[model samples]
Target chain A: MESVSFPPLSRVAICGGTHGNEMTGVYMVREMQKQKMDKTGSLSVSIILSNPRAVEACRRYIETDLNRCFTSDLLSSPVTDSTPYELKRAQELNAQVGPKGSEEAVDLLIDIHNTTSNMGLCFIFYSIDWVTLHILKYIQSKMTSVDIRAIQLDLPISEAYSLESVGKHGFAIEVGPQPNGVLRADIYNMVKEAVDHIFSWLQEFNSGSTFEGGEVEVYTLVKSVDYPRDAVTGEITAAIHCQLQDNDFKLLQRGDPIFLSFSGETVKYDDEELYPFFVNECAYYEKKIAFHLGRKIKLTFPSINLTG
Target chain B: MESVSFPPLSRVAICGGTHGNEMTGVYMVREMQKQKMDKTGSLSVSIILSNPRAVEACRRYIETDLNRCFTSDLLSSPVTDSTPYELKRAQELNAQVGPKGSEEAVDLLIDIHNTTSNMGLCFIFYSIDWVTLHILKYIQSKMTSVDIRAIQLDLPISEAYSLESVGKHGFAIEVGPQPNGVLRADIYNMVKEAVDHIFSWLQEFNSGSTFEGGEVEVYTLVKSVDYPRDAVTGEITAAIHCQLQDNDFKLLQRGDPIFLSFSGETVKYDDEELYPFFVNECAYYEKKIAFHLGRKIKLTFPSINLTG
Candidate 1:
């Protein structure tokens, strides 16, 4: 007879790379798996391949976006309603990876991906939370080249669409902008190191060692960028300036700027408040999402979207 | 390359069954191994089958009793020392099952066993810690069929002389007066449940879950039980009302009531103020030093035979 053990406590899951062309997350998972966790007594981790087929195809899910598909509400529903195939899978995944009582309990979730254009080293965006945000600095400190910054840090994510919307915290770690093959290896290591850091922390804590809590930079989404898309690329290169509507619109403060710059230049045409800072740091083409992070007070604006 | 998990928060080494005759702990290990812990999501456990050959023999050890040889001084000596083979193996086994940091990090090290006589179900003699005592109850709660009681609910364990002592918080979970084979299934399930419980508690705590700790019963040792030997059956039974002596050569206590009842009636007696509660308990008969346990207030005692 098979003996059944309770659901594990701390764990790491590798996602993305569903498209064969997208290899960052898959490679990350492999590397994470290969790394030896000598402290297994303290922590138990299992590696999950989220989209094996999509990972092979090198493109997003054929029918839908898996990321948007996964959520508690859609997953727990008895019927599909108006959800797509990927949406259904997301529901299944949420059930399997959500919390202890629900089905699968996932303490931490990591989604990896390569950017479409030249961008920063690794920029992760998630619903900044108290517990999840606790060790965010530890991750940033371990980085050598790329600076780790949270989106919405500069612009407060509105109350309506805060991190709470996403079950737990999420990290959209951009492994630099796409098109740069050389950086992929470097990106792989950077992401791997972050994952290792999380596991290491878990092992220590599991062994009864504690880390200093507090000190998490909460990123609030002020609003999104809406712009007209070029005929060729269905996606619009985010426009510069305050294009968000005030009806439910909120904008980052004068100094706090966060937005995607797609024109391939630090300077946005038609003088406007852009995710305004350009380091010319890593890559020129990397369409980096700028942010004004590290403030205490939340900047609230009416409902808003920055999708250009 | 072999993957090594993080050093476990706690290690539950299930030995015994060294002699096929006392294959109690082995049964527990088999059940624990069968338990399915969502391998990658939470805590990880490792189980090792110690003394494979001896377990098949159905004897304690080939020549020496492995339990009698775990004294630190003896273990510190050269592996090739003139110590009994049992002592040598003890040296190896102790090092293998030695502590790994935190007090409870290696918490409950249970060695399961069976007695020569088949009278009772199961009983655990722990290091007399409140946590240990509570865990004893937890074990009993999971397996209620057996009468589980701590020898020193209020006593110390330093009563026995001629023994090398280890740390407190250790235990000997005896399974019977003799093996009826039915005990194996119960032993297995008990161990599996216990392992799950401990790991789960550790997991939730590490993940910031609140847990309530409890106190338990224990004993302080005062003296040892000695009996004259037999030449044929090798079973030396203590006569009822046997007087016991302290290391100072003073008559510590007088035995009024018969201590041990082997066949149908009283076989031995105790020398304490209160009669040792025999109550048809399953016990073994052998020409060896025996230890007595009783409850005491705020007491401290050695774990094994003397050299603590």
Candidate 2:
């Protein structure tokens, strides 16, 4: 692979509270704003608390999910009196830090999130951009205290829906095992450390330093598995089995127990073996995702230096 | 102490969805209803979903906390169009299973709940009624797979503000470490087994068996600790410290680290040693409770037989 050259990264935005109940990002962005962290070395940073109404209500969103409101189609959609609050907020956020697919968008957007799943610390991004990949590599190297992994959402730029998709180079730094509406010191610290490392990597990158790249493992999303439901009532009939609970990122065998029905019957996985992530996430209960299956593959990147 | 005599427990009610996001109880009550389990030996069982609106929305409650809406004052208050949905539901529930202080109330009410805390299989009740205490002992003896404990609220029967207080002899079976809006197979099973044991105990007592005198460990309500907050903003500045997180029912010594601030400072407990439970419950975050402090004690109950 040829070394890719890109313009020097400058404007960066750090967003939080996209999902109101996720306290880690909510507090992190607040703490950063409190400290007036506008400039970190060469990069100018903007601290944003997304979806204020949702954050005020301590809900995932007041209307539709704000994280899913950022696709090019939705962002450009005309607003009206009856428009969902999240969709309106999405346009406002895009206007502030991005005009999607434009050169004026922020150089990098690091949106922080916390999941109820025991995913440790993960980077979720759309497409495989070298800049985001190198940052993930840098953070993984620096933050040796916990496991660092990435989930690549295979989607076109125009179709990318998350808040992070608004930036030139963006990814969500998701750290968890923390429940919604509750915060844990360990989980909070892990996020803080990851954010600090991100800033450090930006400084090193902007300082005209050549970066050596190597193979980094990434989990490409395969498909989501919904909980077994009663055909008549549409209520879930079983729960994630004890064997699979909190076992995110573990490869699922064809015969492994995935769900335990209320009638004391075990429902085994009968699909091709794949790693599971977001296993038993709290918010996904409404979305019908018991967990998401992914294929793990290693990607190699080339060394790159910033263009003048 | 002499053995106490009580009327035969003929009518029993099992309530779920009190805090609608607590899925263990929601599913248990639904399952019991699906099986049409209305009769068990000498007892007539009623499966009730206490907060249907909240359950349908999958929220803790629509207007207010339903679990706190069951006091005599709230139950007997005149209904108005503006009254909170939970208060109205509480009154309706009282009419069906309780008229609470009246003789027509159900004999026993087993309200099931799930907490985000690590408290495993706990019984929470008001007053230290002999009937409820004996039932706790029965459950503890039968369910040896998990630690079974009890929390005494120390409130008058008239002042008790919970669905369980609606019955003549009732207590909430709280099992967890399970997050709200999530159902865990282990937690669901624990709640199911505990409910089954309650029925078995009831059947044996109804058959003229005397419960043996024994001492059971209880955590009496002491006080609640809020997360350290910023005075100006009233937002929490700290989270439950790593040392104290998930260590529910563990004795907290004076000077123990109870909170870790966002700036990396540890806030130590400055009060008397106490046992902590409901540590980091998700729903209580809005109620401003980081965790609850309690005093551990052993209550000894005398043998009691049902009077014909």
Candidate 3:
């Protein structure tokens, strides 16, 4: 990809509790709100505690997933008709940092999330934009120990409304292995680091420096693999095969055992070797996704001069 | 304590999903149900899928904890009067396996549970009884790798009514470090072994065998310890200290750090040394319990002739 000049970001927003049980983001936002760390240098920063009620209840969401409610069509719908809890929340949130083309919109949005899967420092983006690549490169540069991977959701989900879609440059940073609603120091610190780095990068950008040359391994979503379920009962009949359990980011060869039934039956993957993430995500059980398969690709961008 | 003769067992009940997210019991029961293994020789076994709704939702309970709803006062209340979901379910359960004094009541109940804390193979009893002790001894002997500890709820909870309380002889077996709703093959096997052992022992007892001459360590609950909280907001400010996060069933000395705050402040335990279990339990967050401190003591019972 050719190096592109970054757009000036005057206003930035950090959103948390998009999925309430993902407490790493909620606590990080709470800590920042409590400390009144609203801005870095001249940039105006906004902290959003999205889905506060769900966060209080320690659930993913009260109604539909707030993340999926970010589609343009839904955003254009009248607020009076938004009866679902998350729909109303989406409207309120969009009014704050959204309506991407509007004058009041924030220049950038950072939606924080956590997962039950062992996906470490996942940078998720709706579009393969320069801003997304820059942030991924910056975060990957600093956190060498963390398994850094960029995931571009090329599925129909591109039209799926997410908190970030409302801003000019919007993306999500997901960190975990932590169970829902439980906070660990390691994850909390990682979250803080990612947020802190974003703010620091923003400050540098506002001072006329832009992230230029870098390369990152990008994993594009292939398809979601559901757990083996009983044909009649629809009940999950097997678990993620022992060999593949917790093996996020690992390459699995064709014919690899993906699930093991209670009766010792094995379900194997029969396609080409693929890199998988979100393996055995506890939260995804409701969605019936055991894991998501991804195809790996490399993205290299040349150095560019960006001024804010 | 004098060893007493084992009581004859004609009926046995294994209860699961008493706390829905504890899937070790739920899956074991499901597996057994699927296999149609309702009898261990002469004993007529019944598998109770307690709190079906909560199990379906992958939550601990829809309302209050079902385990805590077994009190006679609550059980005696009408279904309409029992406003909570669990209260109504408890009444229904009491009708089936309870009203303990009735002839139709189950003679023995084995309620299984799993914890987020690192407690391994915990045998919990409300009252001291030979049946509880012997079961503990037998399981401990068979699974030496498991940290077998007996916990007697010496608090007002002794009358808090649990599923096991309905039977003449009943106790709860808790295994953990397993997250709620997620089942591990190891924990699943452990639960099956415990149930298997109980059924075999019952079969042996019915065939005129008696248990005698055994000693086991008992950890009597002293009190629950809460995590460090903000004095003004009452919100938890710190988490279980790093040293004690998963150190369930381990001795904790006074002056040792029990919690580590976000600000890097350490809150130390100031009381006498005690054994702590259920450390950082995800479900107990609602109850504000970081862990339960216990007094460990050894109990020995002499041999006596048991009759059916």
**Predicted structure with the largest lDDT when compared to the true one:** 2
Model 2 scores what on Cα lDDT? 0.91
C-alpha lDDT of residue B275 in model 2:
95
- The DockQ assigned to candidate 3 is 0.41
Q: Provide the clash count, candidate 3.
A: 6
Model 1 / residue A223 / CA error / Å: 82
Candidate 1 per-residue lDDT over residues A184-251, each given as its tens digit: 23455566677677666555544544344434433344433333344674433333322221101132
Cα lDDT listed for each candidate? 0.41, 0.91, 0.80
Candidate number with greatest DockQ: 2
Ten-residue region with minimum lDDT total, candidate 3 chain A:
A153-162
Each model's number of backbone clashes? 86, 0, 6
Fnat per candidate, as a fraction, reads: 0.00, 0.78, 0.09
I-RMSD for candidate 3 = 1.9
Off by over 4 Å in 3: A80-82, A101-104, A155-158, A210-212, B78-82, B101-104, B155-158, B210-212, B303-305
- The 10-residue segment of model 2 chain A with minimum total lDDT is A175-184
**Greater-lDDT candidate between 1 and 2:** 2
lDDT of 3: 0.80
Q: Is the docking of candidate 1 incorrect, acceptable, medium or high quality?
A: incorrect
Question: Comparing only chain A of model 2 with the true chain A, what is the TM-score?
Answer: 0.99
